[model samples]
Target: MTYIRTVLGDIEPADLGPTYAHEHLVIDGGRPVELYPDFDLSDVDRAVAELAPARDLGLACVVDAMPCSAGRNVRKLVEISRRSGVHVIAPSGLHLAKYYAADLWSERGSVDELAERFRADIEDGIDEHDYLGPVVERTEYLAGVMKIAGSEPSLTPRERRVYEAAASAHRTTGSPILTHCSEGLGALEQVRLLADHGVDPRHVTLSHTDKVIDRGYHREILATGAFVEYDQGFRWKAGVDNGTLTLLAWLFEDGYGDQLMLGMDAARQGYWTTYGGEPGMTFLLGEFAAAMRERGIGDDAQAALFVRNPARAYAFAPVAVTAG
Candidate 1:
């Protein structure tokens, strides 16, 4: 009976249909200020347009995992959702440590304070008018998931601080966590730290696993009951060269298809023009289907990964029955 308040209005979690558990509406590498002199990269219209292809491919929802300070645009996400008729769940948590400028760190007050703010956003709302000014609004409109990352295997002191803040936020707001691991070193450690802080393992998602250590570590993470996202939608070098198919076949054979998911993770602006890939979510789903058929995979197995798996993992409406 969870409720979500979107720009369109409030809706139950059940109303969020077949969803891509991990996707980004907008993204910036947090490069130097001069990188984008115009700074027009914040455009929501362009981001929304990317999902149009997803709508055509039977996608009903996309979780925008882009956190603040990393090109997360909430207000624009609302507009895009309205236009695309695809639910967009935007994030409201912190990003990787390097992207955390000095000002944000100094102003965060403390982990406890940051956690309280995250709770207010989830339980109250982020708008000042709705919560009566920045102080109150700051703590309102909680995030559905907490996000964090580390560039290396061990958590740096600074990243540790952010991890504590995210853990605190999760503890106070009951929000799940999504991690953007670099080189896959600290992710398992981050997960252990979160669990040590009492965050549920089942609620966490280990994302950008394209580079995750081969079979052994992958299975180990799944054994912990965390959702593993294989977002290779943007890569179209060749069907046989792509690791996505291999990973999928392995997961299905090992009976872990229920925990698997796929996404494009498309970030570059002109990537769509290349690789025979379009800017919408539809391309990946359609490709996966085609890949399966080309490899002699059956519809039931394909359906489990494409439709049934995502809906079940994200708590969305079950996919509608359709003729083959």
Candidate 2:
């Protein structure tokens, strides 16, 4: 049966209601924290408290974007899901190069070796040590998504290797893929690269494309059949044209609504209310949602954005089998 995997377990796609396609619920001590202290969101209580209001406001699921060996804590994700009554989908892949150490395993591991590590996370379980230690003790949680990233201007050699490995893992396990399009650049290249590697466009989602406000670029992306996640709705300064909303209006008018999804990508501590921040997680379901309505994004388009698109985008693809 087709299912959307969660930190707790797998669930029917219909059960994953109103999902945030990209988020960072946990960034426990890692290179990210060292470079930016705000990346630390290890406190489960704070995370639970932050998600409570949103959960009550009808937020049902969140695809946590922090992948393995880059501040991902599956145990915390499972706990927050249990406590907040919201399903959390954890990732089992790699992030940008800057987020990892200079000598990280991904820097040297062969594509096959890296694919095995990612596959283990999905099939066996997430490592209790987050793959930091040689001893890998997997917990009950299984990764729901395979995340890969590309640098701006183009994909780095290391990043290309990661994408190749991610595609291999996707082919074997049928897990959906999510990608980080740095500064909203190289999106077309990223899509083409994945397609070359044998990943289905429908099973992939490119994140942060909202950062680029070009309609032509987005049209090309959607034309490829991959989903685009817009998460910069709250970052636009007041008294300025909100590019995110503008893109939404344009795309919806052009009839590409089904190929779109929404998320906060709130990776910093200052983005959450419980962490003493402005426009908390509730911003998406409350303020931005209202804004979407005011901008002529009707109930049908809104439902597709928050519900239908996410269900299909995040659900695992069916693996094809051939008889010898």
In model 2, the Cα lDDT at residue 84 comes to 95
RMSD of 2: 1.0
Predict model 2's lDDT versus the native: 0.93
lDDT per residue, candidate 2, 1-324, as tens digits? Answer: 799999888999998899999998999999989999998989999999999999988999999999989899998999999999999999999999898888878788999999999999999999999999989998988999998899999999999899999999999999999999999989899888889999989999999999999999999999999999999999999999999999999999888999999999999999999889978999989999899999999889989999999999999999887677
lDDT of 1 by residue, 97-165 (tens): 555556663134576766665555555654433222244334223345555666676777666766777
Best model per TM-score = 2
- Residue pair clashes in candidate 2: none
- Which 10 consecutive residues of model 2 have the lowest summed lDDT? 99-108
